[model samples]
Target: MKVVVQRSKQASVTVEGRVTGEISFGLVVLVGITHEDTIQDVQFLAEKVAHLRIFEDEEGKMNRSLVDVGGEVLSISQFTLYGDCRKGRRPNFMQAAKPDEAKMLYEAFNEALRAKGIKVETGVFGAMMDVKLTNHGPVTLIIESKEN
Candidate 1:
């Protein structure tokens, strides 16, 4: 499992001109699952993102976690994160998990976040989506379960 986490002032996802998910102030989490990913990976990432301390505190220090700031999450399933471009101009997506397996893990990840009392929103899985966001501080981080 891999995730690109971005702090956003506001964010929304549109599928076929209809808003699927939106958030006022929170993180836009692009989640990617690989062939080797499992439920354990989903559990690990959900916990990590929930407690990530990227938000700034009163002293202007990045000391507050998403839980502390009461921030929401706009989770999007993004198999493209695993695209491999080492061979040629066109990316290879062999590293991405199959749709059925990926969808199960993706939903599990969201459920884990919601279990933590976080307001989580998501885009339609396997749908063509247009995402918009005002990136707060442009603060972004890439997290991977395999690294752990």
Candidate 2:
């Protein structure tokens, strides 16, 4: 499992011209699942994301977690995170899990975040989505379950 976490002032996901999910202040999480991903991976990443101390505190230090700030999450399934581009012009997506398996893990990830008492919104799985966000501090991080 891999995730790109971006702090945002506001964010929204649109599918077919209809807004599907929106958040005023939170993180935009782009999630990717590989064949080896399981519920354990989902749980780990969700916990990490919820408690990540990227948000700034009163002293202007990045010391507050999402929970402390009462922020939301706009989660989106993004298989392209695993795209292997080392071979040629076309990126290879063989590393990405199949849709059925990927979707299952993705949903579990969102649920895990919600279980942490954080408001979690999501884009439609397998749908073409347009995500808009005002990236707060442009603070972004890439987290992978395999790394930790």
Candidate 3:
């Protein structure tokens, strides 16, 4: 499991010109799943994302977690994160899990985030989605469950 977390003032996901999910003053999470991912990976990453202290404190230091700021989450399924470009011009997507397995873990990951008492919104899995966000501070981080 891998995730790209970006702090945002606002964000939305649109599928086929229809907005499916949106959030204000929150984190936009792009999730990628591989064959090895499981419910445990979902659980671990969800907790870490909730507690990550990327928000700023009164002194302008980054010290507050998303929970501290009562932020929302706009989660999107993004298998392109796993694209392998080392070999040639064309990025290989073989590392991305098959849709069926990936969707299950993806849903579980979202549910895990919701379980953490934060409002979690998501893009439709396997759909072509257009994500828009005002990345606050441009604060972004890439996280991998394997590395943790």
Which tens-of-lDDT digit does each residue in 9-58 have in candidate 1? 99999999999999999999999999999999999999999999999999
- Report the alpha-carbon TM-score of model 1 versus the true structure: 0.98
Task: Provide the lDDT at 91 for model 3.
Answer: 95
Candidate 2 lands at a TM-score of: 0.98
Report lDDT (Cα) of residue 120, candidate 1.
Answer: 97
lDDT (0 to 1) per candidate: 0.97, 0.96, 0.95
Compared with the true structure, what per-residue lDDT tens digits does model 3 show for residues 61-95?
A: 99999999999999999999999999989999999
- Candidates arranged by lDDT, highest first: 1, 2, 3
Over 4 Å off in model 3, which ranges? none
Candidate 2, residues 30-138, lDDT tens digits: the string is 9999999989999999999999999999999999999999999999999999999998899999989999999999999999999989999999999999999999998
Clashing pairs in 2: none
lDDT top scorer: 1
Candidate 3 minimal-lDDT segment of 10 residues: 139-148
